[model samples]
Target: MAFVALSEAEKVYIVHGVQEDLRMDGRGCEDYRCVEVETDVVSNTSGSARVKLGHTDILVGVKAEMGTPKLEKPNEGYLEFFVDCSANAAPEFEGRGGDDLGTEIANTLYRIFNNKSSIDLKSLCINPREHCWILYVDVLLLECGGNLFDAISIAVKAALFNTRIPRVRVLEDEEGLKDIELSDDPYDCIQLSVENVPCIVTLCKIGYRHVVDATLQEEACSLASLLVSVTSKGVVTCMRKAGKGSLDPESIFEMMEVRLVLGRCLDLAGSAGCLLPPWSHCGNSPH
Candidate 1:
């Protein structure tokens, strides 16, 4: 994660703001920064999206390729995640320095969709145990402001929703040989149902209250943070803890209350013809 150094007095100022449910940027404790989303922004990809939250910029591209299913789950396909933090994104990302953060983010993304229900993996299967479509989700950290996980998550969900995998058919010959056929029509492709795809919401525990989308300054004041992966249906697919500070059961429970807010917000966005996963819901409290 990218970080910014802050003095003792500066930390106290941000902490005081969070405790009063007012942040330096005028957002509430549970409010997120205004997020900008752009979809289908890249060529030669099955799907692509760019998300900007505060100073954070993330670009995600999903590529669909045919490969054999895994041995453990022969009838289902899987998603592969790769994260790249360019040197220009942050000073700490120079050369191989950002490898650790990239690997950590990629691993977290894997845990987010490590189940069958997250995606219809069965739909990608052309022949049971023989072949399936593998989705390669590549993430590029164009810039690092704060709340890296949340920004990347939103970009990934948007890309997955935009993915269009070519439909394939199996042709079995008389000699018990099977061949795969691809659709000639460009538009003859299948899209994954993103209704169950999860989005990550990072809440930083600052002072006595928790704040969503904590900027670098706010992060310097935070004692701990929670990463919540929630679906549009309010399901928690994964949870992760960050920072050296420890959180009690009460704090964890309080943070979990935020899980539903993201789901409801997404529902409203869909109804309003918005394709992006807007993480903030104004006038809502997570208490």
Candidate 2:
């Protein structure tokens, strides 16, 4: 994470504005910046998408490859995430730098999609215990204004939606030999059902209030933030706490009570009471 150095006066100004529910960007506490998503941006890959939120830009690509299924989940396929922060995005990402930050974001993504309901893994399976499709998801950070986690999540969802794995059939001979054949039709492919794919929403604690989609300056003024992954159906699949400050019980509950309607979080609602669960906590900021 590239740190934005802000003076004490500037921090005070940003915090005061957040307390008044008016951010410097003219957004409310729960408001998010305009999101632009473009899918199938890469022709060589199976699926790809580009997302821009304010000044932050993210690109995600999904490549489907045949491989053996994991031992434990023999009947399902899995996704592998890799993040690359361009040196041009920020000075801190130069050379071998920002590797830690990329790994942190990748780990957070792995946690959010670890559940069985997040994706239909069974659909990716080509055989009961032998073969399956391994989706290699690669994320590239073109620019970093702030709110990297949220932007990456949105890009990933769009890329997965655009993904279409080629159809293959297995033929067995009487001598117990098996042969695999690929479909001749280019349109013959499997579309992944991303209905349950959750998006990460970040809430930064500023002064006494929390805000979503904080810019670099706004994030520098905050002490800590909470990351919550919620699906289209309002089901929470993952939660993570990050920052160097301590979060109280009340604030944690407030972050979990975010109401998501049609992909927009309007305000806090009581229906999320049953969705909160214990999650892993980290000391580094993933912004």
Residue pairs in candidate 1 whose N, alpha carbon or C atoms collide under 3 angstroms: none
Error of 2 at 247 (Å): 1.0
Q: Report every candidate's CA lDDT.
A: 0.83, 0.80
Task: Show model 1 residue runs off by greater than 4 Å.
Answer: 266-287
Worst 10 residues of 2 by lDDT: 266-275
Residue 141, candidate 2: how far off, in angstroms?
0.4
lDDT of 2 by residue, 1-287 (tens): 87789999999999999999888877777776766677888999998988777889888999999999999999999999999999988899999898999999999989988988978999888887899999999999999999998888888888888898999998999998888898988899998877778888898999899988889999898779988888867888888888898789999888777635413321111112111112101111212
List the candidates' TM-scores in order. 0.93, 0.90
For model 1, residues 1-287, the per-residue Cα lDDT tens digits are 77789889888888887788878887888776666777788999999988887899999999999999999999988899999998888898898989999999999998988888888999988898889999999999999889898888778888888899998989999999999999999999998887887778888888778888788888888879999888777888899899999989999899888768865554333222243343343433434
TM-score of 1: 0.93
